[model samples]
Target: VHIIICFYSIVLLYPQKNMPQQSEAIVIYTGWERHALVGSDIRLSCSFFSWRWTSDDVTFSWSYRADGARDSIYVFHYTGGAPYVANKGPFRDRLEFVGNPGRRDGSILLKNLDYGDNGTFTCDAKNPPDIVGHASSVRLLVFEKVPIQAGVITGAIIGAVLGLLVLVVVIYYLMRFLVARRVFNLSVRSVSLCLGLRSKLQLILYGLAVTRCFFLI
Candidate 1:
């Protein structure tokens, strides 16, 4: 019997050291003009170019302000995964930390948006040796539902249509009345001329008959 040898092959799924290239600074992946419906949730994101190079002790904070001169309102804060602070400010009960700090994600969730929530939101993502360049900002817009607007618009359209129809009907009747009155006036003028002629003829004939009777008597 002959001895047979088999060669084994190994495939590397993940690299042992796959460090992403460092970026100039962290970037907020979420868009700027973030709009949310009232009583809904909105997610604001902040992160660096590479999570692998991010620090585990990174700190994330979110703040908001409706005016520039007023003090910033704290929304949320976090140091790492599962360890965070939903501030005792306006958004205490409605803030959620949905970001993955292990992956360098610093996104926060704001729930049950209100009228006062519409303002400029700022995110701070601070890591060791890179604390100064991890800030990003976004604006939030909250909208409410208006049930009466549709009815008001529909009523305006229907009222316009009805008014136009009434105007058309009034014009039609007015023109018809004017035409009928003109015809009636013409007919009356002709009847008056005929009656005048008949009266003249009857007077002349009566006079001629009286002359004849007188001559006969």
Candidate 2:
């Protein structure tokens, strides 16, 4: 009788653990804000990182709001093993499902970007009990591609300056070498030829001036 009572007491003291209490925490990682040019495409980066895989009851929804807008527009949604896209918004037929929610990939592709599409994008995911940290948002800035990129313009200016500096340095070294090595040793005949050329140039100029004055008179 005492052994039976002890067994019942042990069973009462140690009960089964609740599954919710032992569930792993969720962690959604949405990448940083992206800056893209208009008329170009961009891939939204979103992935969940956790020890446990959320393969069951998976759902993903994406929303966006313009820079000065007060309300967010529903962009895309996926649930019950199917995908739904925005049918009335500008993103209709623009959102491409490029991620696998079964494998923790919740990314998407935004094609033919527009200027008004510049806004904050929210990526929300849910998998039953592991749903709190499954939501994250990022900002996207779109601009006209007609403008030059700041990095490219800066690089071009820097390259031009460097090329000019290299040319100047080469020319300076050549002149310095000629002076230091006494490489410009001109013979008597070379000096005579230079003087002859100078005198001929002066005579030609004088003749041209005289002809101009005679024509005026």
Best-fitting candidate, scored by TM-score: 2
> Model 2 over residues 102-187: C-alpha lDDT tens digits?
88787899999988888899988776666667468899888775457588999999999999999999999999998866644656
Candidate 2 overall lDDT versus native: 0.83
Off by over 4 Å in 2: 1-18, 21-27, 35-41, 127-129, 157-172, 183-217
Error of 1 at 13 (Å): 36
- In order, candidate lDDTs are 0.75, 0.83
- C-alpha TM-scores of all predictions: 0.50, 0.59
Task: Report the Cα lDDT for residue 146, model 1.
Answer: 28
Show model 1 residue runs off by greater than 4 Å.
1-30, 50-52, 67-69, 80-82, 145-217
Q: Where's the lowest-lDDT run of ten residues in candidate 1?
A: 1-10
| Residue 205 displacement (Å), model 2 | 54
